[model samples]
Target: MADTIISNHGSSEKGANPLPANSVIVVLGASGDLAKKKTFPALFGLYRYDLLPKNVKIVGYARSKIEEDDYKKRISAYIKVLDDKVKKQLEEFLSFNTYVSGQYDKDESFQVLTKHIEELEAGATEPHRLFYMALPPNVFTVVAQHLKRNSYPKNGGARIIIEKPFGHDLASSRELQTSLEPIWAEDEIFRIDHYLGKEMVKNILILRFGNEFLGASWNKNHISSVQITFKEPFGTEGRGGYFDQFGIIRDVMQNHLLQVLTMIAMERPVSFSAEDIRDEKVRVLRAMPIIDPKNVIIGQYDKSDDGTKPSYLDDETVPKDSRCATFAAIVTYIKNDRWDGVPFVLKAGKALDGAKVEVRVQFKDVTSGIFKDIPRNELVIRIQPSEAVYLKMNTKLPGLTTKTSVTELDLTYKNRFKDLHIPEAYESLILDAINGDHSNFVRDDELDASWKIFTPLLHYLDENTDIIPAKYPYGSRGPAFLDDFLASYGYVREQNGLYNWPHTSANGKL
Candidate 1:
C-alpha cells in the first residue's frame, strides 16, 4: 500500500475552480523521453506556481522495474530548473510523487496500480482523476481502455489527456476515438496540440479579436493572402527512421500548421469556451478548398558541399529507397463569406537556412497610389526565434522628395516586458488540462476534418513516387524554385528577402 499524505491550500472563490487539489493524476509511460523531459518538468512548473492542487498525487506508471528514488533521479537529470528557488520548490513537490510498475496490456497490473492510487489519496477531500497518456499513439487506446475498465473514479471530474499525432489519417483517428469513447466523454477528453498553447499562438486570437485596428481590416476586401512557415535548420539526425515514416506533411503540417491556420482564419466565437471556439474553427477548416496538386511543391534535403550532414536517403535509419518528403509547401484556399478567393500558403521543413516560425499577412496594394513610391501594407506575427507583432504600412520619408516608404509598428514581448518568463508549450498545456480548460485542446470533428483535407494528398504522394521531392542544400532557403512557385500565382516576394507566409492573408490573393 502506498503512503497517504495530506496537504492543504487556500480555497477558491466560487465555481471558477472546477477541480480540487486532491485530484489524482496518473501518467502512463512515465519513463519515456516525453515524460522526463517535458511532462514532469511542466507539472513541477505548475506546482511551483501553485497552479496545482496541494493535495494532488502524481502516479508515474510504466513497465520499468525502477524504485521510487531512482525514478526521481532519472527524471531530475533532464528536469530544467531556471532558478535555485524553483529547484527547491520542485524538490518539495517531488515528495508527493510515487511510481507503479505495470504491463500496459495487463488488467491485473492496472488494478494494482489503481489500488495504489486509492491508498495514496485515501484521505483526500475530493477524488477527481486525470489520466495523462504520455505513451506513444499505439498504446493510447490500450491504456485508455484499462483506465476506463479498472481505474476511473466514480465521482467528481474525470478527464484524460492525449498527445498528438492523434492518427495517421481520418480512419485511424476515428478508430482511436471509438476505442476511447466507451471510457470518456468528449468533454472529459483533452486532445492536446502543443502549438495551440504557445504564447504567440494564443495571441493570434487576442490580436485579432481584442484589437479594433487589426479586426477592422481582417476580411477578404482588405487582405490579399496568408502565409505560414515553420522551418528548422537541423536535419533529422538519428531520428530519420521516424521522420521518414511520418514525413513533413503528417508530422508538422497536419496538426501544428493546420491548427495555426484555423485559429487565424476562424470566425469569432460567441464565448471563449472550448466547444464555441472549436465550432468556429471547424467551419473554416471545412470551408478550405481541396488542395490543387498544381499549387503544391515538395522537397528533400541534398547532401551539403562540405559533407557535414547526411541527406534523407543517406541516413542509415531511413530506408535507402524511401520516397518520403522532407519538405512540403502548399497553397490553400478558404471559400467563405469573409475569406472567399483568398490564398493561404503553408510551408514547413526540417533542415532549412535558419530557425524561423512566422505568419505574414500581405494586404492588398493601395488601389490608387497616393504615394507613388509607397509599398504594400503588411502585418507579421512572429511566433518563434522571437515573439513580436508588427504592422507594416506606408510612411513619409524624413527627406522632402514626396517619397513614402514602409515602416513597422512593432510590439515585441521581450523588449516591452523585461525578465518575463513565458512558460514552455508543455507547461501551459498541462496547466490547462489540470484546470479543465479545453479551449486549446483539439476536438474530434476538427481532427476528422483536418485529415479529410490532407488524406488525399498523402495517398496521392504515396502512390506516385515520380513526383520526387526537389533537392535543396542544407542551411539554404529551400529550393530555388520557391520564388517562382509564388510568382506563378501573381504574388511578389516582399523586401524581407524571405519566402514565407503571414498569420492571416494581408490582401487575400495568392
Candidate 2:
C-alpha cells in the first residue's frame, strides 16, 4: 500500500492558535538543576530576544524556602551576561518574576500558588496559564492535577509542558498518559523531547523535502544505511545514582536518537501543520519492529586509558554488580515502503570520544565499475559545537592526471551563517509552547510507539544477569563490538586514512 495520511487528531481545526495574550508562564521545580540550568536560561534568552509574549508574566513555584532575592540569584546563576546592557536586561527579566514556596501535591499549597498567579494576572477577563514542569517524572501527574484543581485559569486556556524520560517502558508510559489525559487535553499538554528543537533536526524537513536531489534518493532504493550518533566525553561524575537506573538506552537512545530517526525517515506531512507532522512521526515509529538483542551491542565505560577520569563502576553511587550499559549501538529496521531492508543504526554513549550529536546517511556505492572501492557519498548533519551540513562525495583532483579524491560540499553554520543566533533547544521549545505550537513536541501515541520499541530489550537486560556488558575505556570510541555491530548491518565506513574533514586535528585529537 502506498503511504496515506494515517491520522489527524491533535491540530486545531481553526488553524494555528495565536500566542496567548494574557498568560502566566509558571515554572515548576524552579529551584532544581533542570530549571536553573535550562528552563530559566531559556526564558531569559527569550526575554533577551523579545520573543516572549507581550502580556506574559513568569511565575516560578517550588518547595525551596529561599527568600525572593536568593531564589532570583540562584536561578540567574547559570545565565551568561557579557556586559552592563545584558546585565540590566537580566535584572529586568527577573523583575516581574514571582517565586512561590509550595509542595506539588498539596491543595492548599496550590491555592496559595493560584493566589500568586492571580495577583500577577491582575484580573484579566480571560487568563491563559502555561505550567512548565521541570520536576521528576514521578511527581508529574500529581503536579498537573493540583494545578488543574486549584490554579486552573477561570474559564480560560491552560497548558502544561513536561519533559522526557517519559516512562520506563510502554506500560508505565501508557499509565502516565492515562492519568494526565483526564486533566489536560492532547493539545494542552506539550511533551518535550528537546532533540526536536535542535537546529539541524528541525532543518531535516527542509533539507529532505525542499531539495529534490535528496528527496529523490531518500529511500531504501538508493540509501544503504542511516546512523545517528550522540557521544559524550564525560562520565556520570557522581551523578551515577540516577544514571544507573536508566542507563544510556533509556537516557539517550530511546527518546533523543529515536526522535532524530523519525525526522530522517518519516513521510512528508500533508500541510506542515502540527498534527500532520506528528502523525507521520508516529507512523515511522509504528512501522519499526522491536529491537532484537542480536542487533545490539552494550557496554559500560571503564577508566580512561590515561587514568585521568574514573570508570562508571568507580562511582560510589553505582552498584558494584550493575550491568547497566553506558554505551549502546543498535541497528533497527523499518518495515515500510520507504525504508524496508535499510538499517537505521543508532549509536550513543558517555565517557568515550569527543562530545557530539550527528546523523550520517551513507548512500550505496556507485553502480559497479570505475569507481572501484571508492568512498560512498555520505550526508552528515552535525548538531552541536559548530553545527554543519556537509555532503562527502568522491571527486577528481583539481589537477594532475585526474586522480580521484574525496571532498565535501560543506555548509558549516559558524562559517556560513555568521550573523545568525541559533536559539538553544529549550528556548525554541518554550517559545513553541507559549505560542500553542505542538509541531516540535512529541505526541501521546509517539511516546507509546517509542517505548514499545525498547521495552522488551530493557526487560531482557533486567532479567538476564549473565549478560555482562562489554567494557571500553573512558574516552574511547565505544565497545570493541561496535565495528562488528555496524558490519553486520552492512554499514560502509569510509576507507581508513582516506580522508578527514577540513576541521579537526590531523593527529586525531578531537
Candidate 3:
C-alpha cells in the first residue's frame, strides 16, 4: 500500500512540516474522552500550524454508531481554534478526515478497517501508517493483537501508539509485551507517558546536558536529595470508583513521576536517539532499590466540614469499605554509585489544597564558612502552574551591614520568553508519535523495572487493612503525618509551609 492522498486542502506556509502529509494516522477508541478532548485537538493543532504533511488523513475507529459529519462536529466543538486563519486551516484539515465504526475484538471488523485504509491510500508515494490506541488498559492487549493479526499495513512504515496504565503489575506488563510481540516490532510500538511531553520536562535534558554549570553539580557528590511532587487540588470528582482501584502509586508515580525521576537521574546518553535515552532511563529504573514499607506513607481524603465536597468513599464509583489510598509518599533510594544513600522522595495526592509539579534538588552544605553563617544552595525545577527554573543561594542584603540572605536566580518562562506558546502535553506527545520520535515513550524493560519496585507495596496495601491509608480533609496540604514522615528522614519542612527542603545547603552543612 502506497501513501494515501485524502486531500490537499490546508496551507503549507506556517512552519516546517513535522510529518509528511501523506501519512495515515488511525486513532483507535475515537469516541472516548481522550480522543475527543486530546487526540483530535492535537491533530488539529498540527494541521493548523502546517506541521502535517500535504496529503495526510486521520481515520477514527470505535464501536460508536456515529456518522462522519457528526464526528467532525464533535471534533470541531472540542478543538480550540483561536483565530480566523487557524479556523480556516482546521476546515481544510477536516476535509481529509474519515471515521470507521467496528468492534475492536472482532477480526472481521478489523479486516474491514484494513480494507478501508487500503482504499484511502489509493495513489501516493511514501505511505506511512500510525495506529493509535487511546482506550483502557484492559483492551490494549486485545486491540494490539487484533491490529497485528488483521490491520497492519502490508506496505509503507507502520507504528502503534499506546496510552499509559500499561499494566497493573510487572507480570501483567510482561504479559502485555508477550501479546504485542508477535504483531509489532519493539521499535514500532510506542508506549506514551504524557509527562515526558511537557515543555519543562523536555527541558530537563537541555538544562543538565546543554549547560556546563548545572551539569557539573547534578551528581551525588554535590547534591543531597531530590524531590518530585504531583499535587491535585480537586478530589476524584465522583470518579473514585475507577481511581480508587489504582490509587496514586500506579496512577501517577509508576509512569509520570518515574519518567521525570529517570530523566533527572539517568546518565547523559551518547546521542538524542530514542533508544539511547530509553536505555539510560532503564538503567536508572533498574538500579532503584526496593522501597521499604517503613519509608512509604499512604492517605485518603476524609469528609469536609463545609458539606460541599464528597469524600472519597462517598463517590458512587468507590465502595463504602474501600481502603484505596488517594495520596502516597515514598522515600525511594537509587543504589547506583551516582545516587547511593540519597533519597528520591516522590509525593502525589488528590484533593490537596493546590496543584503543583516540581523537582527540588538540595545541594550539600558548604563545609567551612568565613561568614558567621552560610546559606545552603538549591535548584528548583517547576513543571506546572508555571514552567520555570530557579536557583537559591546566599547573597548580601541590599543596604545592609554584613547581612546575607537567601535569594533566587529566577528563570521564569512567562517572564523571560515573550509570545512563546507552550504546546499541550497531548499535542507534543501526539506529534512525537507521528514523527516516530520515541525518546519520550516507555520501553518494555523500563515498565517492568518500575512495576518490580512498586508492586510489592501495592500488594501489601491490598492484603493488609492494618496498613490502611490515613484520611485528610479536602483543601488541605495532605495527611498530618506527612511532616513526621519526612522529619524521620532528617528532612525539615520549609518556611513556605509546604513539605519541601531548601534547594541549597546553608552554612556548608547538609
Candidate 4:
C-alpha cells in the first residue's frame, strides 16, 4: 500500500524532503530513566532503520556529570545490539551522539550547551534543532525558557517535544502552556501523549474512516456505549510518591485515556490533515459536558485476598493518610447531535487483574421479540499486550438447533501479520517530530479543551478530603462497585456472552 497523503498544515509534501538536511536531535534530561530507557532506544531504532537524516547529530543534555564513555553506556543500555553487524551499527550510532551536563535553569549552562552544539554543527548553514524534554514537570518551563533564550537554532527551525503529567489540573496546565507559548510558537511545541503513538491507536483513524460499516454505525443511534480502559497488574511498589500526588485520574485518565476517547468519538475529518483531525477532536471535547462527581468512582487498593501483596498505603513512599485515588472510573457524555445520548466510560488504575489497554464500542441490542435479550454486537480494538481488532456478532450455534452464540471476526496482528515490526510508541512519535508531522502529536488547543473537560472534577476531588476512595483488594478487578458503575451507564452482559470463538489460524480462518 502506498503512503496515505497527509495535508495538515506544516506537514511535508509527498516525496519531498523526508528529513531536514542539517539537524541535531537533543534529549534533555539524558541522565534520567526515561531518556535512557525510551528516548535513546527509540533514536537508535530510527537510526537502525535508516529513518534519521543521514548527517544528523544526536546530543544528550542533563545535569548529571558523566564521562563520555559512561554516557554512551547509559544511553545504549536499553538498546539491543544483537549480532556483530548490529553491534557495529550501534557503535556507529553512538559515534554521532554526544553528551552535555548543565543546570536546567541556568543561562550560563545553556550558553555552554549552545556553544557545544555550534561546534558540532561545524559551519553548517541553517541547522535545525529538535529538543526533547524527558525531565519532570517542575523544570519544564524554566528549561524551555533557557533553551529559547540561549540555545535556539540560529537559522533552521526548532521543535520542542515534552511528555505528559502536563499539569496537576487545568490551571497549572494553562500556566505551563503560557510559559512555553511565549518562548515557542504553538507549532514549535509538540506535546507528547505517547498513547497516541501506539500502533493500533494510530490505526483508529484508518479503521473508522476507511470502513463504511464501522464508520456508519459509530454514533449514538447505532452504538450503545463506548469504553476506554487501562489496567495494570502491579502497584507503584516503592515509587508511590509521584503516583500519590496525581493519583490514577491525573496519571492516566486525564490525558491518555481522554485522548483515546477523543479518537474513538471524534467525527471524520474532511481530509487526513493534522489540523482537521485535531479540530474534530477539539469539537468533540467542547461538545461534551463536564464529568460529574456522581458519575465517577474512585478506589484505593488494599491488601490482596491471600494477604501476600501490600496495600497502596503500605508503600513506604506513599503518605499514610493520602486520599489519592489509585483507581478511577468516570462516565462522560457527549451533548452533540452525532452522539447525543451515548455514554463514554473511561477507566484506569494500578494493581488490577492484568495489564492491557483497549477501546470497546458496543452496538445497540437486536430490535426483535424472537431472541431472548440477545447480547449486543461489539467492536473491540486492543491497543497493547496484543494488537487486534475484533467484532463480536451473534451467530447461529453450530448445531441442528437454532440457538444463538457470539462469535468474533478477528484481526489479531500476530495472527494476520507474521514477522511484522510494530515500532515503539516513542519511536513513531520522535520520527513524527523530526519529520514535522503533528498528526499524532497533541496540539495546544486540543490540550486546553481536554483540561476544560476535567478541571472541575479534579478540583472537587482535591478539595473534599471527606470523599474517600472506596477500598478494593490489590490485584483484584478494581472496586466492587465496578459492575454497578458500568451498569448505571447501560453496560449489560448477556448470560450467553461467555462463549468464545475458536482461535483463527494465520490465514484468519478457523
Pick by TM-score: which candidate is best?
2
The C-alpha TM-scores of every prediction are: 0.92, 0.95, 0.91, 0.95
lDDT of 1 by residue, 1-510 (tens): 134343332211122335676788888889989999888888887887788876889989999999999998976777777899878887887888899999999999999998998898786555888888998899999888888888877665578999988989778989998988877899888999899888999878778887798889899898888889999998988889988878999999989999999989999887777777889999999998667788899999988757787787878899888888888889988888998887888999877888989998988877774544246677889999779888876655566575544556887878765556788888898887777787888988999999988988888888897888899888778887988887665455774432123321333222
Q: Is candidate 3 or candidate 4 better by lDDT?
A: 4
Candidate 4 residue lDDT tens string, 1-510: 133354433333123223476588889999999999999999999988999987899899999999999999999899997899899999999999999999998999999999999988887788789999999999999999999999987777788999887888788988998988878998788889999999999889888887897877878889989999899999998999988888999889989999998899888888666788889999989998889998999999999999999999999999999999999999999999889988899999889999999998889888888987788888889998889999987777666888766778998988777666899999999988887778888888888888988999999999998999999999999999799889888897543435455453332345
Q: Among all windows of ten consecutive residues in candidate 1, which has the lowest summed lDDT?
A: 8-17
Every candidate's lDDT:
0.82, 0.88, 0.82, 0.87
Each prediction's RMSD to truth:
6.9, 5.0, 6.8, 3.4
* Model 2 lDDT per residue over 79-188, tens place: 99999999999999989888999998899999999998888888887888889999999999999999889998877888899988798999999999999999989989
- What is the lDDT for 208 in model 1? 89
Rank by lDDT (best first): 2, 4, 1, 3
Q: By the lDDT metric, which is better: model 1 or model 4?
A: 4
Per-residue lDDT of 1-510 in model 3, one digit per residue for the tens? 133233332212122124466778899999989989988888887776766656887899999989899998877778877889878888887898899999989999999998888788776465678888989988998888888788766556778988988888878888888988877898788898889889999889878887898888888898877889999999888778788778889999988998899999999887777778889999998898777888899999987758777789888889998888899999998898888888888999998889899998888777875764365677889999788898876676566476665767888888776566788888888777766677788888888899999888788888887877898988788899898887676553452431122333434223
Could you tell me the lDDT of residue 106 within candidate 4?
90
Candidate 2: where are CA atoms >4 Å away?
Answer: 1-14, 503-510
